[model samples]
Target chain A: MIEHLPALIIAIPLFGAFIAPLFKKKQSIAAVWAILITAITVILSLMLMYQVRLHGIIVYVFGADKPTIVLPSGYKVPIRIMFEIDGIGAFMAISATLMSFVGALYSYSHVKAESGLEKYYALLLLLEVGILGMVLTGDLFNLFVFLEIAGIAGSALVGFRNYRGEASEAGIKYLIVSAVASLMVLFAIGILYGEYGNLNLAYISRQVSLSTLDMIAFGLLFASFAMKCGSVPMHYWVPDAYTEVPAGINPVLLVSTYASLYALFRVSFTLFANVSISLERVGWIMSVLGVLTMFIGVTMALVQKDVKRLMSYHAISQTGYMLLGVGVGLTVLHNSDALAEFGRTAMAGGIFHIINHIIYKSLLLMTAGALFYVTGTRNLNEMGGLARKMPITTLCFIVGAAAISGLPPFNGFASKFLIYESSYRLNPLLAVFAMVTSILTLASFVKVFASAFLGPPLEKFENVREVPRPMIVAMVILALLCILFGLFPDVVLNKIVYPAVDALINVAQYQSWGGLA
Target chain B: MISKLVTGSGYWSPLLWLAFLILFTLIGYVIYSRGNPSYKKESEQVKPYLSGNAEPSKEKIQVRASDIYWGFIEALKEYYKVLQAIHTGDVRDYILWYLGVGTVILFLLVGGA
Candidate 1:
């Protein structure tokens, strides 16, 4: 089971995705099949986490007994494709699949009356497969392949309802940006492959010299991945796409965004670990990007009237926290003792926020989906007094709002507290900016809550009811996790988050897992 | 029963905070919930006040969502103008921004190298 788990994780979804269209005749069946595929993928991800704990850093090379780092003829590095599952990969995998599964479950009711049901679930599974592959694959070129698959699938999903308002426009925008980004990533890979003569990441890392071209390649990869993750100046497409897509699909898209962020970290920490560039300077550059993203996202969110668009901007803002945490980690990369003192905590804060943000952000979006499900509109002015009609959705939204705002005793505050306190140790201004962003985030959500949910009931929505049970169940699960994780920060900190941070910093363990040493 | 999650550099224990929050919340909820009924619903008491003129319909009287944060938006007008200009909603401009950043990064990083 351990030997075949990697292949199975990707294969189940890849095969199941194609089969999803077959059940088009029965749309309900298609939805069920999607749920099953995603559920199994989630379980497999959990199992991989357990297996990695029992036996550290499980390496499953494709078509070989060993990692195949040493070719029988002569070469001295890994040549075959491989899947490396460590604590970080498992954390992301489980988060992605778990969210994807929940998104599918919610999609059933949300898209039931809409057309293109079959294509919707198919793209859903394929998107998850792409994200899973991107995180789990050990080969650099293979990572690019997964990145393309995700990019394409994500673009199509963004325009699932192409005939509707601005959906097609958003899709085209996303496609063009993705094409440009992918080309940049591809050119970067070409440079690396030309320099090192290897496509495997661990192999390339061992042999890569910090030539001028290599530095250029790293810069290209950084810009492209940062754009893919919706950083500022590169984030204009985010609000358009998030608002246009079927609300059920937004959560899965959020997971994919995290996958791109994971790529950014992996490329910098592992791929360029031994490079000759001033990592601390690079870290400062990334820190500037983080601060800009946080401020711009919240300010733009303040002026938006559409509910989904408003939350979409917040998603970009939340990405800033993760970037900031990791940026601090990189800024202090030189001193191992200092890194252990605060850098690890910063990485842990960033990675932990990835987990927290996914839960609360998706829950908030699904509540927005439920609003659209009944209200038939995404505009905030048109929605009023919903709390009286749909109590469950209201409750879920409150939990999500409180969490996203970093109110104490929720998951957001726990991760953010780590980021705030640790980053203050590095630079007080970064912490100050982060805290201001948090306050602005709260203010923005309050506006949404007041205008959209808590106002006097609109006459048209007199009969509004709670969302379907499956949708509510999905939201309840996320909400429960938010509260639980918040209450027991120490448990999550010790058990899941700190381990992933350790895996990230320990590039040697990753290289040895590839059998490069 | 307060326990601390001391990570050496940072600590975030929700125990004391949670206790304080629950205490204040209960006190607030009790005071707010104790209010007696002083007015009738669907009566003249429920009518909107509009400086002695007849009240407009709810939709007409209600504030636009965008208007809610008008002051903040105005204060950040210069910043927003630059931002909104960059987000021109045109595909060509979007690509330009993407390339423009790519070029900047290429120079910034390669120059350092």
Candidate 2:
């Protein structure tokens, strides 16, 4: 049973999504059922994490007589579907499942009054399945399948409030963009299949020769995944989609974007690890994109009046720090001295930022949702003096805001500190841009705190109260994690993040699981 | 200790920072406690004073969200103009940017290869 935990994690959510609609009339039961299903998936994902930690990497072949049989009988390479759960995959799985669990909990009270409770919960579960599959699957074609599932479910949920024209419009835009990106992914997969005749990532990582077609495929995969992850100047759809997504499930949707980011890193570090691809050139490109993403995201966020839209732009901006950090690592990939000096730390900073970003970003979005729940609006201009009415939500918002701003005693600062220290060694300008972006991020959140939470209490909100206990619980879970990760950065780095970075840079271990080495 | 993170160039210890923060906070509190006792909340001294002029309504005095960064926006008007213009919020334009970026990446990779 433990050996099959990888398959069970995905299968449980897939099955739960199908049966969720059965409790259509029983909305309360439906909420409980959804929470229970997500909770079970979270537990299974944790079990899988522990297994991977105990046994290095777990390769579960779907059609083989035994789960460990990567090459059956006479076959030279793995032709069957398989899950390759390494350190990073396990790390992302934990993040995705934990986020889905929290989102489910928050949705119980946030959307209970809305109609279509059944489909809403179903789509939420499907979204989780999609994210889990994307992070866990080893086959390239399987990744494409999961990407589509997540894209479709995420798009549907974005447009779930169909009565509002903006919601429907945002949903349609998201669907079209997702379809195009997924098609590009499929095309790239087809290119790889044509060249190597195998869809397994580990197998292909061993077989790739860096041909012209391979370069084209790598380009397509890089651009498409980067776009999916909401990097600028290709990030136009992010604010529109995120601003309109139901605040309850917004964090999960953000996790889906990170899944795409995982794919991007997988393609760069794992798929092309052995090839003599121009590491410096590629790294520079990524660093440039990171700088642009951070600067533009914050500038746009600073001018926004809508609460969620501002955060969405900040989401794009924060992604820049990750890119810059990891890009610095990639730049020094071949130089062991530079890699040891600053490159590994930079990558660690970037990787560590991913988990930290999800925690504080989720807390921030939930607080935004709580504000919307009470005020019936998302416009910051329409809000004032909420600190007096909803003290708990205000405190959560301050934690999230301070964290995202890279203030001390919060998770965001720890990751940004790593990024700043390492990126500065590569180029002073990179670190300077990062620091400027942090300042701008602080300014943007200050705008939100002042305009939305502070000031004299508005007459209309005199009767407003704190959000429900469940929403508070969800936010508190993430808020505490923010502080925990901040205060004890080395524990998380040594236990979780370093293993992931090692898994990415060390291609032999990934290939060994598939008998490719 | 697990609380200390040593980057290649430097180190960060949030626990140490917290300890200093607590110490300073306590010191600040002691100083605050010895300050003027005449200051009181919900008193006439707490009311808004507009340079000895009549005070405006609460709604009028409070700065709105858009007005918070008026000068900053004005300072970067040229930059914002280009940014806002590019972000037309059109799906067609979004696709164009995607294709444009894709073409550049393809060129760079193939050229480098």
Candidate 3:
């Protein structure tokens, strides 16, 4: 039963996704069922994380041969794709499931009047399947397949409001860029295959030797992953796409991108372990990019009249923090002297920031969605004194804003403090720049709060009321979790987070978990 | 020689850098004090251009969305035209670009041997 847990975690959603399409004639029931499916997935992921915590890494292989017939030394380790869960994978899976669930629940009313509600629900489930698969899978090729699934669903959801020119335009841009990035990844995978002759991540890790070809493949793979992460120079489509997407859909896209980033770390560690390339140089590049992205995104967001566009720019800025953490970790990992201490600190900070970003960013986006629901507009200039009508949403948005701006006593602040503390300890200049960015982020969120929640209540908003009960429930749940994660961060860092970071850092342990080496 | 002088980590380079910094500071100070009058004008001219008769009230001024950003995007209209022409929007063109770049990469990597 425990062995099947890994596959069930993803399979339940994948099956529900396909079955949802058949219920096209009954959109109402299908939407409820879709919500139920995501709920089940969230529960399963919690159980799965608990299971991984008690036990070690969970590995499930396909096509088992009667108690696993002993294989010869030279023979391949059975061609089955793996779904292994450790600390990071579990955290990502839980986050993805929760976001997908909330996004699904909100969609009940948010998308009720749409033409193809059934199809929307189905794609939502499919996207959950893709994200879950991306997080849980222990194979590179499988990761690519799931990436494609998520990408297609994301593009479709972006274009769901097909009548709007902006929607169609954003969808097309996302589709083109996503397709190009995936192709770049596939081409890199092809190179890895020709060289290593295997697609399993652990096996590839053991086999890959640092070489010119390998380095080139690594560079291409990094570029592709960066594109997906919406890293600088490749971030043009994010604001437009996120702005055009329905509020209910924004969380799914945001979480999926972070999930992809988690996959990137796993694959990168596997392929580039002990390579000649300088992880520090990459780290420096990432730090500069993070600095640039944070300032630019916030400044642009400040100028936006549309609430969605502002939130979209905030998404870009949040991606900067993640890059900063990961890059610093990689930089330290590249140097032997700093590998033992600084590397762990940096990597932990990075992983912590990833989790924090997921929480606060989703909260912020959902708050925006809730505002849009009540006021029927995404322009902050058009909204005023909504705090009086939607008190719960106002509280949630302020918490999210405070957290994102890295204020004290919130999940965002805690994680970002670690990042700033570690990065600054590593290099004072980088830390200073990061601090400046954090201050600017605070200034930007203040603008969001003032324009959207404060000031004289617009006349048009006189009749405004709270969002639906279910959505409020979802938002409150997220808000509570954010506070819990903030206050007792040690629980998360020690139990859930460390194991995940350990999973990536300690390749030997990963190898021993499976029969890869 | 200029590149060498700039790149070298020597006293001469430090002197050159200091000279450049001083020059930049002087120019920046001047610019900050009097650089772009348009910015100053925009802030001071928040009241609709009165032309000395107490400009039209806020209720009379209508602002539209299209009036923003498109102007900057339009400033480089020729470049945008070139960009638009190159972007065929066909899936095949995207694929071709991907494969062409892939082939070139492969050649460089394998050719390195």
Candidate 4:
């Protein structure tokens, strides 16, 4: 049973999604069912994390007598679908599942008054399945399948409020963007398949030759994943999609974006690790995009009147830090001295930021949701003195706001410190841009805090009260995590983040798990 | 002993920062406690001095979100013009950006290859 944790993580959510509609008439039961399933998935994901930490990577092959079998019956190639659970994958799974579980609990009260609770729960569970599958799968085609599943479910959830024209419009735009991006991914996979006659990522990594076609496939995969992850110049869908989603769905959607990011990193460090392509140039590209994303995202966030839209822009800005860190790592991949000097630290910062961002950003978005639930509005200009009514949310918002701004004693600061120190060694300008962005992020959130939560109590909101207990519980869970990760950054880095960085850097080990020498 | 996160070039210890914060906070409290013992809450002396004008409603007094960074936006009006123009909120324009960026990246890769 312990060995089957990988399959159980995916199967539980997928099965839960299928049976979610059975309690259509019983929305309360449906909510509990969704939460229960997600909690189970979260436990299983943590178990998988422990297993991977104790042992090494766990590669589970589908349709095989033993979970360890990658290639069957003396075959040179692995044809069966498989899940390659490395440290990074397990880390992401834990983050994604935990976020989903909180999302489920938050949604229990958030969407209670709304209709179609059954479909909402179903789509939510499916979204988890998609994210989990994408992070865990060893096969490229399986990744595509899960990406579409996430994309479709995400689009539906974004437009879940069909009464709102903006929601429908955002949903359509997200759907189109997701479809085009997925198609590019499929085309790239096809190119790889044509070149090496395999779809398994580990197999392709072992057999890749740096031909012109391989480079094209690499380009497609890179751009598509980058676009999916909301990198700038191609990030127009982010604000629209992120703002329109049901408040409870925002974190899960964000996790899906990180799944795309995970795919991007997997491609760069593992699939194309040995390819003769110019990694420095690719790294420069990512770094440039990172700087641009950080600057533009914060600036746009500065002027937004809508609370969720403001937070959405900040989300994009934060992604830039990750890109910059990992891009620096990629730049120095072949040089062992440089990699040891700062490259690994840079990568570790980026990977650590992924989980940290998920926690704090999700908390911030949920606070926004809580505000909307009570005030019946998302516009910051229309909100004031919310702290008087919603003390828990106010505290959570402060923690989230400070963390996102990279303030000390918070997780964001620790990660950004790593990125800034390492990137400064590479080039001072990169760190300058990062620090400036952090300052602007602080300024933007200060505006939000003052406009929405501070000032004298308003007459119109005299009756406004705190959100439901479940919502408070959800937000508190994330807030505690933010403080915990902040106060004890070393514990998180040593226990969780370093192993992921090590797993990512060890391309030989990744390939070996796939039966490659 | 609190663990320090050593990042090749430098290190950070949250415990040390916390200790410094606690020390400064205590110092601030001691200084604060030395002043304003006679001050009273909910008194006429504590009310806002509006230059002999009547105080307005709380909502009217509060600054709106749009007004938070008026000077910053005004100073960067030219930059914001181009930025806002690019964000036309049209799905067609977004797709165009996607294609445009994707094409550029593709050219770079294939050309370099």
Candidate 4 - chain A - TM? 0.99
lDDT of 2 by residue, A37-149 (tens): 99998899888878877888889889889888888887888899999999999999989999999999999999988999899999999999999999999999999999999
Q: How many Å off is the CA of A310 in candidate 1? A: 1.0
Candidate whose lDDT is highest: 4
Q: Provide TM-scores for the models.
A: 0.96, 0.98, 0.81, 0.98
Here the TM-score of candidate 1's chain B is 0.74
**Which candidate order results from sorting by DockQ in descending order?**
2, 4, 1, 3
Score each candidate by Cα lDDT.
Answer: 0.85, 0.91, 0.73, 0.92
Give the candidate order by descending lDDT.
Answer: 4, 2, 1, 3
Two-way TM-score contest, 1 vs 4, winner: 4
How far off is residue A510 in model 4, in Å? Answer: 1.0
Clashing pairs in 4: none
DockQ of each: 0.55, 0.84, 0.03, 0.79
Candidate number that wins on DockQ, 1 or 4: 4
Write model 4 residue lDDT over A53-117, tens digit each, in one string: 99889999899899887878878888899999999999999989998999999999999999999
Question: Mind giving the per-residue lDDT tens digits that candidate 3 earns over A97-146?
Answer: 88888888777877777888878988998989889988888777888899
Which pairs clash inside model 1? A69-A77, A69-A78
What TM-score against the true chain A does chain A of each candidate get?
A: 0.98, 0.99, 0.95, 0.99
